[model samples]
Target: MALLQNLPYVPDTVRGRTVGRSFQAVFLMVLVSVLLVGAFGLRLFQLQVVEGDRNRQLADTNRIRLVPKRPARGTIFDRNGKILAGSRLSHTVSIWPIALPRDKWPMVINRLSKVLNVPPDEIQKRLEQAGYESIESITIARGISPAQATALAEYTNELPGVRLEAEAVRNYPNGDLAAHVIGYTGELTDEQLKARREQGYRLGDVVGQMGAESAFESTLHGTWGGQQVEVDSAGRIISILGDKPAIAGKDIQLTIDIELQRAAEAALGNREGAIVAIDPRSGAVLAMASWPTYDPNIFTTRITEAQWRQLQGADHPFLNRSLQAFPPASTFKIVTTSAAIESGKYDPGTVLPTYPYIQVGGIQFGDWNRAGFGPLSFPGAMAWSSDTFFYQVAMRIGGPTLIEMTRRYGFGRKTGIELGAEESAGLVPDEAWKQKNLDEDWVIGDSINMSIGQGFMQATPLQVANMFAVPANNGYRVTPHLLKDNEEHRNWKESLELSDATIDVLHQGLRRVITGGTGQSLNVPHLPPLSGKSGTAEAPPGLSHAWFGAYAPMEKPEVVVVAFAEHSGGGGGKVAAPMVLKVLEAYFKADQNAAAAAP
Candidate 1:
């Protein structure tokens, strides 16, 4: 009261108004404070409960990562258990962008380049392929040598987000031997990944590109596994959270004989040709080779554009010549001879006047020899490869009958071998087919040319081998295959319903060819009695194509071999027959060696 008496005096109405304003201000301040407290409480509840799992996951993501484990591809082995394509322990360099930030890439990549002996641009390209912002690690280099791996490991402190991982990489032990049959593997394209995502194919997965490797892909590609790991700030794995062990692919056993394969490829050295050897009893491809081959091991890693172009050279080195088609030449006369006998037009004793040339539609079709043998019976005609005799027989048997016989011999269609897509369905021309494709009418000249396996008639070396296999196996047409004891091919063979007389005549004629005819050179002391037919097909703008198809042991044939020399100057007797002879000699010598080794 004394302090108030000292203060300035005010009227009763002004004092009441001031006191009321102060009380109002106090109440408004309390209300605002309560509202602010409620809002903060609500926000706290949202953060702790509503977004708990998501926040926890976001926090874990900064320290956790997934590491992929690649599965080991299947090992490919020959029938004798020799490894053809297998896998070996290798070290790969991988990088994680999270630990090595974008700004640090140039420095780390440069240091890595020095250690790995790799170009900076290549490392940069690999990073680009993996992407900068990706949470996953990227493979920069695979199959690094031990020296490079050691160097990179020693420099790990200087290079962040880099690691060396041990894994299995594809390896071809024999280098270029059996290259076509084993094929090659490469990383999958984006398109392949998208298409094969259901099969668990990832971005860096390696897959078969050709030959038996491609054919048996499903059996060779094992299931992939992975590990969930917790890592430090430097992207080094601190602990393994989860691990799924990789399932290795199953091993594959092929019908190929490595010894015979070596022999086939050696015999075809440096020549632009093909050689195929098959087991007549089982339809197993003992050996198949193509010249100008590349080392499939070269494709095990990242192949440069120049190397790829070199592989796909003008000679088409990748082409499996055994599966490609060309004219069969006089080797096709076997079909014509069968047609003639089957049609009741000629027999083994029936003789024909085989002149040097024949006139058809006022066109003179000359034989290989201007001065031909005056007369030849059926066996003599076959032994001498009388094109004129076959021409006369073809004209007598008619085009339809010859075409039917050709179809019976598995011509004009793919052999349905284990090798896929590369096999060609060679053309077998009929009157209707001629009208549809060539837009021309079939004449007697077509029949005459077809009789000798020329004039648009083509057959792959594999087909030619199969053709001879029929007579070799007592008239059974077997489907050619590479995998040993494949379930899908249990019923691959079928009887051609040929008469015993036909088989005997074919054997007799083929035997005479080896004994006294063009293929007489193959009658060496190292080999048993052999039977075969020689072919020299006319190829314009190049030399003639030489071909020889043969089987060993006139009484019981176990093997069939076909050799084709594309555009090689000379007769089949000189160029192709010798190639076949070399293969046969090697095969028999190996057999004899094995027998002698048995105690």
Candidate 2:
């Protein structure tokens, strides 16, 4: 109290003024604080009342989950109801990248590797590489055992973001049989996914990769369906609210006979060539076999680099030679003869001068045997496959007429079969084609070469088979089909109006080829007579391709068979005809056995 009394003298007026200013400053500070608090409260109220539902909806969108819709692919079957392609249920362990904890990833992968038998390094690599959060990690053990799946399921709590799912995997029961026709399926690539996104295919979806599977993918690939699922805050599915079941794709019944197909494959006997058999009456292809084929089963799973390289390294095993073009060789004589007869330039009894080697213009063309008959009838000439006979006839008919007739008969054009990857119009080298490709002027020599199925005459095995079927069916050219059902069924019986006399002569000649000529050895020992033609097409220098085109039971034809062997260095009669005989024998014996067993 003494120290305070000694501090200062009294100044009552000054002290009163200082006290008043301090009170004003305090009052202003309190007022500003009250105004700021009031503004913040008003803003909070506005947000709660005006934008609350919208904000809540935005939050819900972040939480909503989506599940993939996997549709079941279609089943494929042979004509006799044999299953060719089907699907099986498989369990796969997948990871959702977004849900995985970054720091705990190593621990998760290590535990999965031990429980699921997957390599830890592999799991880690996949996780790191799979950048998309939505993308499922595919670290499936080659095949997960049931015990392993159960163990993984139990340990899922320990391994976050990893889950086991039931998915469909394509399977081929017959393996490599008819692989070229049935084809295979695999996971869609990025380009394929983008092109087919709207068509219901997703990033990881499997679709047809080749053959009939590819041709009819749209019809065979069923419509995808989905379910609305309710999930918890962690995005784990709690329950399915509503489900739209996926529709299984339509089942395809092919016209191919598996038994016949197998028989053809066996008869081919490690040969590099093709065989196409068609029902002459209905134009349905009974068998289309290309040798050196691969198993479709391998493709159902991810194909290894080695397997793909081997297939590619093979002698083009994937090529469908039956549908692809090859020089028709002497097999084309049937068309030339028809053109000659149709043009009224030649008849069955018309005799033509023959020679061993005829030099027309500048080209010297010889017959198959390098021998000539002094003069011969049309039937005799065809029975012997007389090159001179055909050459004379072709020249008489002229190039333009032959081209028109052949085109009318469906040569150098697609057969309109249901199969995909068909060959379009092949070369029927006229003056124009020769001028364009060979850059040479057309002459009589060109006509002679064309007449003999050389020069610029190329046709597929199907085309050659169809060529033979024309005369067998009495001048009608039915479009060949691999499917039994088509919209153009009415046209099968429609006659193309070839001359009856020409048909008879050509038929007799073909019959002779089997009974007495080059195809004599092909004639059955005990069964009904078969009619066919043998063709030897000259290749580079000393090499030659063998070809046989035929229809069995000459009296009442049923099946037409065409076979070709490349670089066989033998006549069609020696190489291809014998094979056809074996096939026909098997087919007939099977039929006879079936008939005998019938009650």
Candidate 3:
């Protein structure tokens, strides 16, 4: 090595040092190579073993999706199986926003707007409402027509991720016919969602807003179903991993006789009034009608603000006058009659002098007839609706007795109909109620007014029908309902503490009302024997309200019908009795035809 260093290329011991340095460099390089390989192995183990499950889940999330499917709502039918409300198959347009480039949305939406016959601004509005970071498909249009759906299908190749989804839309065949009873459906409000969130009511859920629809929401709104799908990066479905079929809602049948309902509505005839007819034996409502009504079908489509405002007219078309309370007029005399007989303070033989006017608290309350029917008994007094006669009877029996009897007959309270919040518990004034609400003391005049169904006393047409229903049903106060043969109503009636004598007196008095009294207009010879009472009530600031309540086939009464005409100029004998006659004719025409054919 020394001789080699001394050569021209090397110095003394440089060759030895250079050889040592070369070996050190080789060793150092090998050590570094081992360290690098070990580090890489450790990192590879962590990535493949420690966090592998989490990374796999993250990868799956990018391609897997859950799509919800809505179930069909229940159908509503009349007692005769006529479809009142039903559901129709409809399509909704949806889009997987991420499937198409954001920049291309304007062009796609524009073309879709033409096919949908909707404004482009509306589509853009819906998309913006869906937020930019939404992972699920967004709804572009709901309840689209089949023609529009077909047109969209033709352009699906150009529209990328746009597609059609199946849905159920509510449909009311008869436009305005039982609008109050059937009610309407609308989107779930934020408050409703908050209240029903845990019950699986989602943000976009449709719910019943009023009437029987609201009362039976859970029974009508069916369960939701969903599918788990696997998709590619462009949001294209690769396969459906799992799917669940939705459960359909059950059908509901109402007790309404469509024929009777039509007749009742026709009889009402644009009057701001209500008519109710019920089967006294079963308490099944045969017909209920209110005028100034709206087309519930308008709610099925997108209702404009103007149309909605128009529905809330001054007369209040939405007001179910059958369920709403008003001055009951002479119809309320039935309550006083019950009180008089039940209290044992008065009898059918009890006679009182009825005058043209009665003096009470220095106020002269006049009778409808200028010359009162002279010294009439209870039967005669009730027949003529002698306000002065009842005034004396009410004072003798006391106001407490009348108020108590009113409640017993289902007055001053809701009739428990399935119409829900649409019902009004009408005002029944007494000493305590007057003191508390009106800040006035109850006096003899108040009792006199109460006897006549005037002065703060109010009642619904349903309650009036029920009042007559009690006597027609032979002392059992039935709970009126719209469900046909409802098991719940089997034991719904309460047996009153009335005696046979009281029922007889009631029948006798009501019969006299039709035979020769104020309601003689309804006492046609060709028709079955009828018992009824006609009333003319004083309503200040407007004309008196006309009221008539009647039940036919006096021996075994089957039906009770009540008619009311608000602010009608004429008396009940002339105005409301005719309406009742029309409905009764419609109801009995079928029976008459059957009898005629039987001969």
> lDDT score, residue 29, model 3?
99
For each candidate, what TM-score against the reference? 0.91, 0.87, 0.87
Instruction: For residues 212-286, write the lDDT of model 2, one tens digit per residue.
Output: 888878878888776666556554878886688888788887778888888888878788788888878778778
- Angstrom error at residue 131, model 1: 6.6
lDDT of 1 by residue, 486-574 (tens): 63548767888887777778888899899899999998877899999999999888999999989987678889999999999889999
lDDT of 3 by residue, 220-319 (tens): 8989887878987656689999899878777888988888899999999999999999988878899999988988777665577789789876989988
lDDT of 1: 0.87
The per-model lDDT (C-alpha) reads: 0.87, 0.77, 0.83
User: Which candidate's lDDT is highest?
Assistant: 1
TM-score of 2: 0.87
**Model 3 stretches with alpha carbons more than 4 Å out:** 1-51, 95-141, 146-162, 485-489, 592-599
| Candidate 3, pairs of clashing residues | none
RMSD of 1: 3.9
Best-to-worst ranking by lDDT = 1, 3, 2
CA RMSD (A), model 2: 4.2
Judged by TM-score, which candidate is best?
A: 1
